[model samples]
Target: MAFTIPENLHPDLMPLAWLIGTWRGKGRGEYPNVPGFQFAQEVSFNHDGRAFLNYFSRSWIIDENDEIIRPAASEVGFWRVKENNVLEVLLAHNTGIAEGWVGVVKGAKIQLEMDQGYSSPSAKIVTAGSRLYGLVEGELFTSYDMAAQGQTLQAHLWSSLERQSEN
Candidate 1:
């Protein structure tokens, strides 16, 4: 499929043009002390002729039949691309956690490592985290590893999302 760059997008964000759209799919998540579960997710990225892209993601717990059970996680953030393909991200989650991440973009793939994080008094502290995003066979594939609640960094979630048609 051919992707056209949004006409007014900042030149710094050209490399990330492929991600400027909405994507939806299902994913599975598991962590120590938490029951494994399936979820449906929607992620969207958009730009406003600036150097950054706005990002938003929401997920809902789902049953074996792919029926929604309850709302899960949600987050909003911004992604900025700097010189040398350096990427910076700022994210705030519904769970009262805010994080800063840094990484580099290698073509269609990006790897991010947590740089800092803040947790509200009642939220769990995430000691470390890493995320990988890539385009695989035209689908967006994402994976996350996290260290939290006294556990070491390990796989926590993964999903493959197909781009949604522009309305």
Candidate 2:
């Protein structure tokens, strides 16, 4: 396919144009005392002259042999630039999740606050939080500062996504 960028993309968003493609990769995640899991993630970013970048993501659990075993949740979102020099993103996951964020976008990093929609089936709503994202050593990474359970800060779901040529 030929590379043709949209004319309306704000100059601030031009830096992210390179990321407007399909990316497949593997990553690892851990939660509390539960064991970590290896998974394959695919992300797609697109633009259509709107103020935001359309986004879609899907993931699957992979075994030691790197074979997919089951399907994971899927997410759709949008990334945009706000007037106050802040970057905003709207995301929704098929697993009953959605969020809107406003933040700052550095050269290769993004720091934003996140409002988790409804991920777990337990309650209609949960907590809220803020997070920071940095492209470290050419890898995407993130950390969270969430407020919930009458307790504040805690680090959760931090991972680096190394580009995979294919699934």
Q: Pick the candidate with the highest TM-score.
A: 1
**C-alpha lDDT of all candidate models, in order:** 0.94, 0.65
- Worst lDDT run of 10 residues, candidate 1, spans 158-167
State candidate 2's TM-score: 0.74
Encode model 1's per-residue lDDT on 54-157: one tens digit a residue.
Answer: 99999999999999999999999999999899999999999999999999999999999999999999999999999999999998999999999999999999
The CA lDDT at 163 in model 1 is 90
The alpha-carbon lDDT assigned to residue 151 of candidate 2 equals 53
lDDT of 2 at 7: 69
Write model 2 residue lDDT over 33-78, tens digit each, in one string.
5487877877777777666788787889889998999997577988
Task: Provide the clash count, candidate 2.
Answer: 0
RMSD to native, candidate 2: 4.0
The TM-scores of all predictions, comma-separated, are 0.97, 0.74
* lDDT for predicted candidate 1 compared with the true structure: 0.94
Candidate 2 minimal-lDDT segment of 10 residues: 158-167
